[model samples]
Target: MTTILVTGGTGTLGRLVTERLRADGHEVRVLSRHSRPYAVDLRAGGAGLDAALAGVETVVHCASTPRGGDEQAARNLLAAAGRAGVDHLVYISIVGVDRVPFGYYRAKFAVERLVEESGLGWTVLRATQFHDLVVTLFEGLSKPPVMAVPAGVADQPVEVGEVAERLAELALSAPAGRVPDMAGPEVRPLDSLARAFLRATGRRRPVLRVPLLGKAYRAFREGGHLAPERAVGKVGFEEYLARRFGPDGGR
Candidate 1:
């Protein structure tokens, strides 16, 4: 069994990927900023990183700072991996990052470039937004009776487990650059997704689709964040909500 080090192994997707990899009989080490067992901070690229990569054959880079500083972190990790002669580096990225104009998307795109040019054997899997993100968005906007959502925007929200499983599979295989994008089974409007969340959480709110004005929002409205041709995830938003909030939708 190969030893694998998973960056951002404590986060939502990272944790699931770590579990799946361990289940497959691989020795897994989780790298994070916090001082925990098997944790290494990617920002500190020194003895800590060297120790983390000592016997690791593969590196699954699931760590990302959407808010800021992702590119620097990626560079540090790539440099350390190259020095350690890592066999493969698998990067988990978002779908439509190249097309989207948001700052976070741009950062992710830059990191992708680093991995491609890092000279280490690498694989990049771009998946759509997760169900958890969708839920979190609605939860933040649930305070008012009239919930405002972006009109004309579409999303293909996939399950985190599906992404985790795919990451594990890719980490075990030969490094392939930029694999097929993974997306949810259905492509639904943002308004509809918000409505489903509201109904599931037993919230009595009128979801209003407001026309947003911004290049990023426009890109989203034009389906820049969608992968209609690559809808691989089996879990739909309704099914996901049903499982979480029950059949009656907690109403």
Candidate 2:
């Protein structure tokens, strides 16, 4: 059985990927900042990576730093992967990182470049935002009777499980540089998503649309993060909420 190392294995997508890989009978190693089995902090740059990379045929990088410093983490991992002579390196990134003008997206775009030029056989799969993230956004925006959201912001939120399965598939195959983007089955406006969440949670909050005034908002409005033509994922936002919160909505 080929051994695979999954960074950010404790995270939402990473956890699902690890489960899928193990279910397929591959020996999986989890890389994390916390002390655990096969843990390695990417921030330290190869301090504990050699042991994790040993006998590993592939590395799926799912860890990210949205606040900042993502490039350094990626570079550190790339260097270690090269030193280990790993055959394949797969990275999970957000869709529209190159087009979005946000700081986090810019950082991810840079990491994509690093992976491409790392001289190791590699594949990069960019997926739309996860459903769990949308829920978090809704929770954060909920402030009593009125919820304000940016106008024209839309998203194609895919299920974490689907994205994880795709990542696992790529890790098992030969490296294919920049594969087709994966996205949710449908694209919905930000306010619409919020409304769905409210309905699911049995909450009645009037969603107020606030005009967005930034390049990042404009890019999102223009469908930069959407992949309507390549909606490979089968789960939609409404379906996810129904399954997660139940049919009659939750308390």
Candidate 3:
């Protein structure tokens, strides 16, 4: 059995990746800060990484920092993997992160560069925003019956499970430079999406428009977040809404 080590195994996508790998009869180990029945913190150096990484054929790095200064983390893990002689390293990133000028994007891009320079066989799977965006927009846009967001923003959020499955598949394959960037089937306008979320939650707030400055907003407003047609994931907006909001749309 191929032993696979997954960092951030406690997260949504990471947990799913670990669970799916185990289900497929692969020997899967989790990297986490918390101690669990199956957990190891990647941040801790060699002693922190357990025997799971020993004789491991692959390492799937799902752990990440949102803001800046993750180069050290990448260096540490890549260095560890390099020492371990791991066969492949798979990294999960965000779509349009290169195009967007956010701090987090900068950090992700930095990691991308690290992988390229690390000399270990590697693959990167850039994914679109998650369904969690729906819930996030609901909370961010609310202001006591009135909601506001980028006037002309657009998005194509995919399911987190889809991303997890893709990562699992990559872990089973030989190291490839970059995988197909995954996204949802439908390209959704932020305005309508926000309204749908509010309606789904049985909220009576009216969504308002607010334009953001610079390329950050323009990239989002101009369809920079949609996935290539060939790379579209199986799930779409309506299907996800129905699953989360129910037929009548309520808890």
**TM-score for each prediction?**
0.97, 0.97, 0.91
RMSD of 1: 1.2
> Candidate 1 on 1-251: residue-level lDDT in tens?
99999999989999999999999999999999884665566766777888888888999999998778898889899988888999999999999899989999999999999999999999999999999899999998888879998888888999999999999999999999999999999999988899889888888888888998989998998999899899999999988999988977676
Lowest lDDT sum, 10 consecutive residues, model 3, at 35-44
Model 1, position 162, has a per-residue lDDT of 97
In model 3, state the lDDT of residue 92. Answer: 92
- Give Cα-based local distance difference scores for all models: 0.91, 0.91, 0.80
Writing each residue's lDDT as its tens digit, candidate 2 over 72-186 gives 8898898988898999999999899999898999999999999999999999999999999999989889866799998888889999999999999999999999999999998
Q: How many angstroms is residue 156 displaced in model 1 relative to the true structure, after the best TM-score fit?
A: 0.7
CA RMSD of all predictions: 1.2, 1.1, 2.0
For candidate 1, which ten residues in a row score worst on lDDT? 35-44
Model 2 misplaced regions, further than 4 Å:
none
